[model samples]
Target: MRPQTTLRRLAEMKAARDPIVMVTAYDYPTARIAERAEVDMVLVGDSGAQVVLGHDSTVSVTVDEMLVLAAAVRRGVRSAFVVCDVPFGSTEVSDEQAVATAVRFVKGAGADAVKLEGGGAQRLSRIRAIVAAGIPVVGHVGLTPQTAVALGGMRAQGRTTESADRFVREALAVQEAGASAIVIEAVPAEVVDVVLPQLHVPVIGIGAGPADGQVLVLHDLLGITEGKTAVFVKRFAAVGDAMLAGVTAYAAEVRSGAFPAAEHGYPASADAIAAAAAAAAAAAALEPGQIAD
Candidate 1:
């Protein structure tokens, strides 16, 4: 088995200019696939709310639901570091709430670290609080989905001067608040390039351009998510179409009575069958009012 990926190892990779690979996984099967593919990180992303649970948005997912996903991912991952996203309302109330939620991900689900969205003043405080509790935290900035409505409906960030400045400020503040790494999502690559040198922690980019690492939603990459996806998503495989084809073939076989053929079943001895037939004959012969011995 491969050795577990750690924060120190990730930092070393960043220093060596080796790009890290991270992917979202919601269940045991996906986690196993990620481990087999040799990904460096497996994130139980809140994106599972839409991709797996059929929720309209990440904000609708709760901590309990997130814990279930995280724990399953942890069970299947042996080497890749597992990070769980603390759902929307879990940490917004207070710094203490953030710590509590982070602890649950660490203790209850065996997460290597927890990821929190945003880098506002309150968000930085939450990051600091979680880090102070001895849990490693991954900070997220630029197009935070939990609050995307306020950011104008999931568009790319940092295209304008004001947004670019805020991106830089938030990115730096998150690093200063004790995040071991940061995920820069849905921001212009040019904007990310300018600020990359200013931050010390490894920056994992989604749509924000090449950083120390890159992460994509597993479903998006596997062509499992139907309809439109983010601009940055690159489909790597057609696993969804393959799955549908496989199931369709199975249904056809079943309808044709081709399934469960003789070869697919066990056989009983001739004597055994005869004995069962004689027992049935005896039972059928008994009178309606009488009890059979």
Candidate 2:
């Protein structure tokens, strides 16, 4: 079996200029697929809210829901690092509350690390507290979806000079606050290039552009997501279409009675068949009034 990926290994990969691969997985099957692909990291992202739980946004998922998803992913992951996203309300209350939530992910879901969004004062405090509690953290910055409305709705961040500076500041702050790694999303590649040298930890980009590593949602990459996806998402496979075709074929066969052919039947002894025939004849010979509806 392959050995598990550790924070040290991640840092070494970054230092060696080896491109890391990260992907979001919600459950066992997705985790197993990710493991089989030999990806470097598996994130049980709050993106599950939209991709798996049918939630309209990431804000609707709870810590309990996240734990269930994380644990399921954990069961199937053998080598890649598993990081669980702390949902919106899970860490907003206080530093202690954030630590408690992080502990739950580690103890309840076997998460190697917990990811928290943003790098505001409160977010920094939470990251510090969680790290102080001996839990590894993966920080997220640039277009945090939990507060997308406050960010002027699901748009790219760091596009303006002021926003770009803030984005850089927060990215550094999270690292200083003891995050082992950071995920930058929906920011300009130039801005990311500027900050890359300043950051010592592994940087994983989604829509943010070239970094030490890249992460994409598993469902989006596999074409399991319906409707439009983010601009950065590149569908690598048409699994959704394949699923539809398989189910359609099954339905058609069932309708035409082409399924469950003679080969599908169980063998019966001659005596059993004879007994069934006798029973059918006796029932048919009953008077119309005697046969119950």
lDDT values, one for every candidate? 0.95, 0.95
Q: After superposition, how far is residue 15 of candidate 1 from its true place, in Å?
A: 0.2
Q: Who wins the TM-score comparison?
A: 1
Candidate 1 error regions (>4 Å):
278-293
Cα lDDT over the full model 1: 0.95
Q: Model 1 reaches what TM-score against the true structure?
A: 0.95
Error of 2 at 87 (Å): 0.8
Task: Assess every candidate by TM-score.
Answer: 0.95, 0.93
Model 2 lDDT tens row, 106-170: 99999999999999999999999999999999999999999889889999999998889999999
The positional error of residue 254 in candidate 2, measured at the CA in angstroms, is: 1.2
**Per-residue lDDT of candidate 1, residues 1-293 (tens digit):** 99989999999999999999999999999999999999999999999999999999999999999999999999999999898999999999999998999999999999999999999999999999999999999999999999999898888999999999999999999999999999999998988999999888889999988999999999999999999988999999999999999999999999999996899999999999999999999999999987879
- Reference-based lDDT, residue 145, model 2: 97
Candidate 1, pairs of clashing residues = none
